[model samples]
Each structure stands twice: as C-alpha cells, then as structure tokens.
Target: MSMEGFSKVFEMYEAFRELSLSRHSIREFRDTKVPQDMVDKILELAATAPYASGKKNWDIKVIDDTQTIQAIADSIEAYTTALAPKIREDFREGFIEYSQSFIAFKDAPLLLIPTFKVNYSLSLMVEDEAIKAWERDNYVKSIATLSMIIHQGAHALGLGSCYMTGAVIAQEQIKKIIKIKPRHDIAAIIPIGFKKER
Candidate 1:
C-alpha cells in the first residue's frame, strides 16, 4: 500500500479508538428530543453488524412517546416491587434500591428495544441438548453486537445512550404496550438523548 493510504488507515483507526474510549453509559439525559434522521442513521449503521448464517433475525423498536416511556418504567418498578416479597428480608431493601437504577431511561427522549427472532440453527441438528441450547445463545450474541454498534453510532452523532437489559423483567407488560411481534423477544433496551449537564 502507498504511504498515503497507510496514513489514512491509521488516522481512521485512531479516530475509532478515540470514539470508543470516549463513550460512557449515559443514564441521565436532557429533555431534548433526538432527531428522527439521526436515529435512522444509527440504525442504518447498526444494520451492518454480522449475524449468524448471514441472516439478521432482529428488529429494533424505537419509542419516543413520553406516556409510553413512563408506562414502561412503571411496569418495571412494579415488576421488581413484586419480587421484593420473594427475597430474603435482609437483602430485600437493597434489591429494590438496585432495581430502581433499571428505570433510568424513564426520562430519555428515545428508547430503542432490539428484539430477536429465533430462527433455524444448524446446531439444532446435534444430538446434545446442552450444545443446542448453548448454540442458540449465539442469536443473543449477534443482537448484542448490533446494540453496541448502535451505542457507538449514537455517540458519534453527538447523542448519549445506555445499553440496558433490566427492563426485560417487564417484558410481558411491555408487550401489551408496544406492537412487538410475538415471535420476537426483547434483547436489550437503549435509551438515547442529549446528556444531562453534570
């Protein structure tokens, strides 16, 4: 390769590294709304993630309604609250407190839920049940990779976002509120917006 080409490659690597290192999981966001075009760009970039068997068996659900966001947050808190009684008395309070952190996206202007649809896997042809189960998990790994790319894309677009799974606890309630298809399950929930001033 020419020296000029190598220099350009190095510059791209340096810029990517800087972007990766600078991103933080932003839990607090300002009230500013994220532009639809910006969100579309992030999703477009995330679509490049490699998936199993070269098939992308996932869909992203973007939520920007304030009432819906609040409803989802309330459902999560309610779900965790229900679990409190099942916990040991000593840890009960701590568990509830920790769960509160899960709803940090309640105020974010946008919420992104990546849903995964389980499809045919060659691993299922194997005789071992354990191996099949383990291989099925690769679907999740692919979605996770896509999600990370979404976060980086958001950061590059001058927005803040957080990757969260705690909201999965309220999947049942959330399903009722959202239009996600029955075949797909929630993989992760990402909240994006402008970062709140510290």
Candidate 2:
C-alpha cells in the first residue's frame, strides 16, 4: 500500500486504540445528570462481555436516586476514614486518597452495581469440587469483565465513570438500601456522570 493509504489506516486504528486507552477512573464529575436511556445503552454493551462456559452470571443493579447514592457515599467515606490510619503504611496514603473519591461520588448521577448471582454457582450443578471452585471464580471474573465493558461504553458516550470496589466496604448497608437479593454477589460499585475538566 502507498504511504498515504497506510497513514489513513494508521490514524483509523489509532482512533479506536485511543478511545480504549483514554478511559480513566473519574473521581470528580459535573452537575449534569445521566439519563436512564443512555445508561441502558451502555448496559447493553456491558452485557455482551464473554464468560467462561457460557454460564450467565450477573445482573446490573443501577441506582440513580441522589439521596440514596449520597447516603451510600457517606457510608463509604466514614468507613474509610476510620480504617485508613489502621491500614499498613504502604497502603495508608492511597487509602486516604480513595476515601476522598468516595466522598466525591455523592455528586455522581448514576451508580451501577454489577452483581454476581451466588445462586448461579449452586445451579451449575457440578459435583466435582475442583470444577465447582473454578466455576465460582470465573463467575466473579465474568462480572468484572462486564463492568469494564460498561465503563468503556460510558466513556464512549462522552461521560466519565469509575469502577470502585472500595465502596463495597458498605455492601451490607447498600444491599439493604437497594434491596438486593441474599444470593447476589456485590462485585463493585460504579459511579458514572459528566466529569468536570481539570
């Protein structure tokens, strides 16, 4: 191919690669809120992620209410505040920074919880212990994979988002607030919104 043609191809491929790499865990967001239809579109992409054994394993529990999200963020901030000092010195500083992120999440417009259904593991019906263990592990992996796809999809739509497992520290309280079933596994709490440019 000519240099001109090759350059076009290079730019085309680079555009796609750039989109994938540009995604960062957004901590701060703008006041604008995300609509449910937009979120549903992202969820569609997320649900396309591949899983081992073709076993369906997750459910996206999306929360958009400001009051509830604020409460959840408060719980995370308070918990992290109490725990940060007691953690190992190597992790102390990062933990403190992450706690601030939790506090910031209060302003986010959407929160998505990609949960691994615990009942899916039991329903796998594999009698062998080793295979069962592997299946259980992959179920969680599948959920993480789904969350990553959704995060990317959100970015593609000009929105910023962060997948935060640190917020899982408030899982029980969140579960009660969200009314998640007992058999659902909380993988991570994701916050999505318009990011304020630095």
Q: Which stretches of model 2 miss by more than 4 angstroms?
A: 1-12, 81-98, 102-104, 119-133
Top model number, TM-score: 1
Instruction: Name the runs in model 1 displaced over 4 angstroms.
Output: 120-127
Q: After superposition, how far is residue 81 of candidate 2 from its true place, in Å?
A: 4.7
Name the weakest run of 10 consecutive residues (lDDT summed) in model 2.
117-126
For model 1, what is the error of residue 22's alpha carbon versus the real structure, in angstroms, after optimal superposition? 0.7
lDDT of 2 by residue, 101-188 (tens): 5555677888888887643454466567777677678888888788888888899899998888877777776776686656887888
Clashes of 1: 0
